[model samples]
Target: MMKSIIDILIYAHDGRGLGHVSRSVAIGLAVRRLFPHLSVLLVTGCGATAELIGEGELDWIKLPSYKTKISCGKSCGDLGPSNIDDKVLGTVRAESLSDLVDVYKPKVILADHTPQGKHKELLRAVEGSTDSKWVLGVRAVVGDVDKVWSELSADTFTSRYSDILWYGDSSVTGSSELDKLSKHFQKIPFETGYVSRFKELRNIVTDVCTHKKLAGVVSIPWSGEGTSVLLEKVAEVLGGFDISEGIWKVYMNHRDPRVCGVKKSFECHPNVYLEQLGPSFLTDLANSRSAIIYGGYNSLTDVMGAGVPSVVLLRGMKDGEQEEHAAILSKSSSAIVNVFPEDEVTVEALRNSLEKCLKTKVEPSNMVLNGAANAARYLAELAGVRDANG
Candidate 1:
């Protein structure tokens, strides 16, 4: 008789960014592929993220959306609505998650990034489950360590959590930083490379017949206030640079219909095209001559992996991880140009950066990792679905 594999539940606090949802879905898909018989559940806060994942082999539970922010440049935490009380919001989050936990009865719960999802009720559910395993899935990059440590320390769920899984390459953080953190808790630090949901579909390249040069402008999903200001600045710079001769494609990852108005304002130029978000998003990226983008680890990695040079606009007053990431990549002889939030992203500055990138032939191959397969393998091992050793 065949044995049944344990079920796994992956939690994602999507809120306003695509990074959490995108990474979580990749893990779910990988786990499913590795253990076809294993049951997988994806709990997400973003409806767009759920829709993006669709009704695939894995089951999904959509949680009520919550707003999050980086406090004091070091920690990420939830913010209460202006009119609503903290207790009210917390109650709502907890109740919604508690109901789902009772209905699903997941065997193992894997949380991505956020610790207080479902208003900390999800943690209680997992702790109450006698047979369930609990794991926290974290990315290679994180906000201020001090703030995160304080937040985690204060939460009751931190002690009850089973293991901490670092999703990116461990080498990036160095031995000293890892040692300091490891002293505090049982850290199951594993580098499954970068969790990317990039599918290599038919490569369809769009032809540009114009004699002028074209550049691609990619923006983070409309959530951060700084990102919006940056977009406007980019538009202003492009307009001044006679960029109309060249095409500019404003790329949005959320694919939210509400963004249409914003895209029209930023990308609606004689030479600009507003491309909505979709699975084929990266394909368009691959075909672009150059890219200007916000600093998200996965997206930045993908752009570099494609061997395309980029101008990384570091979101100011945000998490320092992105700046650190860009800084690390920048050491490679113009692999990436790091621009601060306060820096004027003028047309001349952008034009100069693009020119330098076009002239330089630095190949950023060292950063690329065979992440998807490794991540899948890791999930398989965790689920105890791997074949017996010889």
Candidate 2:
């Protein structure tokens, strides 16, 4: 690591789910790995950032956060969309961003999801930066583009950002929302197949003995940052399972088992071996006989990378990004079984998938999971950075 030539500031407005924050973390990790001299600063509202991003990194700024109204129907936990005023909130966030920009003087500013942020704050904050590269990172499907266009308008698209970074595969499939925004796209888009933190597994496809070794893993899926609407439902369905004979580990992400089932404590859940999240919890999923997990961006790649035969959950609704990813991955390989909620949750599919994953030995797919590294190297190029040798 030589003299620091650039500093990268990533603004991840986690008004939605951990998806945006997680994706940004993957990119930041990649950036730090590629440009060891470049310091990465991430600004986020996700409460789990401190716990997930590691301590003493001294790289994150926590902000007063709010969650999307769509995700949280009635119960607005702590802070929700109804609790916020766009005008006042925007002004407050803009001031904080502007102050940070003046001091940090970032060489590259990457704004995830919204260019205007939760309330048009990013547009107002980066007004005076003459040397910084402004970039907008977007997912494949970002909801009704017409609604987005009406909210942001055509005027907001011109000269607001330097590049459009798309983190989805353009050839195999496409995002309807991104397709609609294509006419407004001006700059060259840097598209990555998908941004995943883990590299694709090589040759560790040994089968987990199900009958011989009685063990399983369950995780409640979350759709947004503030609350786990999906988790609450899944937990209830899982509570009825009679797995007392086997050891079951559950990652109750945002759901309380008491609210759903799990009458006993973690220590007394009889069959449930573990139900708490830890620093290296994914390792447990990677080493499981079979597992049930969410279909989020990172979760999909991480489990697939782990080469564990698993069951993926879907909300079975429109504008759900995970559904598409689940469809693609499930089709690409037979390692994962996709399950959806019908009328209510169809847990039978989960049970069947678990039985199949546990009893069978499947070959590992050769799909590449190097998107994080690719994104890191590409962002370095976007910053127009060159090493001393170059």
Best by lDDT: 2
Error of 2 at 121 (Å): 2.4
lDDT for each residue of candidate 2 in 259-363, tens digit (9 for 90 to 100): 234333344435655455433445566667677776666677666665667777655445555666677667765557655542244445555666677765557
For 1-390, candidate 1 gives per-residue lDDT tens digits of 223243677788654567777777777776666567778888776656643454335567775566666444432446533434444665776666666565666666777765545345455565455555566666666756443455553353455666666656545445443453455444645566666565311112234122214555464554454445555666665555455445666766434434543554654456666665655456556655567776776676656655566777765545567777666556642446545543456656766776565455446455435554565555555666656111
Q: What is each predicted model's overall lDDT from 0 to 1?
A: 0.58, 0.61
Which residue runs of candidate 1 sit more than 4 Å off their true CA positions? 1-6, 50-58, 68-87, 114-119, 145-147, 151-159, 199-214, 239-246, 253-268, 332-335, 342-344, 358-364, 388-390
Q: TM-score for model 2?
A: 0.78
In the predicted model 2, the residue pairs found to clash are none
Candidate 1 vs. true structure, TM-score: 0.79
lDDT of 1 at 124: 55
